[model samples]
Target: MAEAGLRFGIQLPVQSQSTIYCEHWETEAGPAELAQAAQAADRLGYAYVACCDHVAIPRRLAGAMGATWYDPVSTLGWLAALTTRTRLLSHVAVAPLRHPLLSAKQYATLDLLSGGRLLLGVGAGHVPEEFEALGVDFHRRGAILDETVQALATALTDEYPEHPGPRFPFSGLAVSPRPVQRPRPPIWVGGSSPAAVRRAARLGEGWLSQGDRVGDLSAQLRLIADVREQSGRSGPFAVNAIPPALYVGEPGWDTGRHALTGKPERLAEALSAYGALGVTHLQLRPRSRSLAEYLEQLEAVATDVLPLVRS
Candidate 1:
């Protein structure tokens, strides 16, 4: 049912094509192209479709970022109307930028409207300029993020939520459109910093690895295991891995030397290594030059690869 043993999801291509993970085709992409890709993923049985969050890019980082981030809330909401089963995720929303009540209202509406399919992944944001422009102190972001997660957990779960924190204090006000999911959606914590890992261990339903390699993932998994055990946390916890750039099948051109290219079974064999190391989910990407090519890759993974891994 779950592609054998592990659950897999993709960060939809056009939403936040940062240069680090951007494909050549994304530069030429627009809303139509994005909708097509998101719909295809839904059809192909991906466990979830993840969107990224970033308010603005500083001039210094714009070149590297490609300046093409669509707001996660708007993008996810747009695509949610088009798909049925697959869950929607903010791969890592910057919760510190906005008050938790606002975040709760927006995402709770998303969950309510999307038939309760929402996983609210959150993170400590990294951009100095973005935080400065929003009037939040950058150096205090880690603490702020911790508090934000606590606040969001409360606000998302209760019909009439209250948050009493140094930055935000409120009560006696009711937030409407309670999430369709009873207690609230799952909160997966993101980032690879030491602080982030601890927060996830202590607070999150899952850990979203930012940029850790396979070797790094194994170590991170071990560390998380230790942290959870040490803290005596008994709730459900998940470990995520973003593998090397994947090429689902033989390619006519060089996508890159690091690309995992070969038969689907071969690729599954490589990916199973991550599963063996206790990773419960993977956020995979494919190398492609067009939406058609990308969808083909998705189809191949769904058809040819996943079953073999399960076997």
Candidate 2:
């Protein structure tokens, strides 16, 4: 849990990327391995464990890219069972893959089972081919995502939710077992676009920034803050940023671009810079090839890095 007025979290790259920025880290993380990693994170006092949500594997970037992705809902359901404290999240579930009612039901069960420990992060997806493969119109996803957000929120509340929208309609239906979080879960809107900022101000709990671009992150967050203020919402809405990797001590790890690469003093300085910029949460991850390397990175972060900056 956060302080009385603020909340913070970390993101785990649970999809197990084969290569990031064309450099190989861990090529594969099996189901058991993922579960163990989640357990380890819980033991380390992390607040959130987030997984990338994808319906189909994108092709040919790496030879090992096609390995089975552990489904976020199923994986989180198990993670909730395995860990008593850590919250589970889909970093950015593609909104067009599943119907809003079904998505609401799935997350509600997970939230209930996890004792309301669910942060529902959603995104208007990229990857045109993935949408084509999923049999959804790639162009109209923005409208669809808007409807999805509203419908999910409604379905999580009223037993017989009814909506006649441009995208879809739901009437005379009961989506059972409302989420453990009253009204709905904390729906985080991700992306750096203007639309994303407006959406977050209008309907989301926070704006989750992605990728390695810090200048972009700063500007987007400023826009979110400004928009929220224009809308007359109070301050202290979450501004979350995920650094690319926490690979401290790795050769050629750019400390300039990412906050989590460097010795304790340097990392602390970088993190303080984010804090100065009004970042309430900084989500860090370690880039490594094996379990030993991963744990080593985590240990370095816990021992050398965390104490330097954690509030």
Candidate 3:
């Protein structure tokens, strides 16, 4: 049902260990494991390898959202050196947490160092405490994110970019080592809220859904289309989805009832449904017990499932 072939990518583990998605093995893993995962993604022809971002985690939420979030800029910058072709993605950096210029400087250098393989995924962060700590108003994060996205577009595109705004206003200052991507690297807005989707349509090159149910995607896509039409924006806009955790074949251990498990053909048939819903790319998390098992699953996806996805 896909209008075109669907692309696949992975959100690198051992970085951010949220109770909702983190596998048991990731807790014991470290940088070596992270590098291997990125390397495998690169060798296996994945579209990108994603990293999460969080400046700090309040103790109240630390138990659930562990404080293990590796800085996306630092982590992705390191992974960039290890992988050859896989694009580096900040799964949703809370850009409003810092000044737009600082964000621009960090990402611009990353794009330059990575030879232009950067996907700047931005989001309005959820934690109120984090905003307070950073001197950013939690309630105004959405508006700040909008302005930040616009500022980033200009900053990444021009060495002496200027933008006058209520939140961030600057001119005449120059940032060196501009992003290698012409007109700037793709900015993918993340979140499933109505405001988030509208921002993506208006400002972003793509939309990164935050675990929206498959049943909800059609409505979201329609909303994106409506907003884009209203805004008179037209161009290539990627639609991304994070499907349920996947396992290529029958799992030896319990992968839970929600996981998509079975033979490659069955898995492909299930995954291809997202394409029918207008998802251009998928961010997959494979269910596994260890790094070895994780790599095996990635191999299975690349070899057994990927070939049959479009067929």
The TM-score-based order of candidates, best leading, equals 3, 1, 2
- Residues 1-311, candidate 1, lDDT per residue (tens digit)? 01135887888898886888798888888889888878888898888888999999998999888788889899899988999988898988998999888998999999998999998999989999999999999999999988888888888888777787887777878888899997888788999988899898888888999968787776677677788888887756777678876787679897887788889879999889888888888887888888899988888887888788767
Candidate 2 residues lying further than 4 Å off, grouped into runs, are 1-10, 21-25, 58-68, 232-236, 249-260
Q: Candidate 3 on 10-45: residue-level lDDT in tens?
A: 999899999888999999999999999999999999
Candidate 2 lDDT over 16-52, as tens digits, reads 4534422243444466667777787788777788877
From the highest lDDT down, the ranking of the candidates is 3, 1, 2
Per-residue lDDT, model 2, residue 247, is 66
Q: lDDT for every model? A: 0.85, 0.72, 0.92
Taking all chains together, each candidate's TM-score versus the true structure is: 0.96, 0.87, 0.98
Whose TM-score is greatest here?
Answer: 3
Model 3 misses residue 149 by how many Å? 0.5
| TM-score: the better of candidates 1 and 3 | 3
lDDT of 1 at 246: 75
Off by more than 4 A, model 3: 1-4
| Structure candidate 3, residue pairs in collision | none
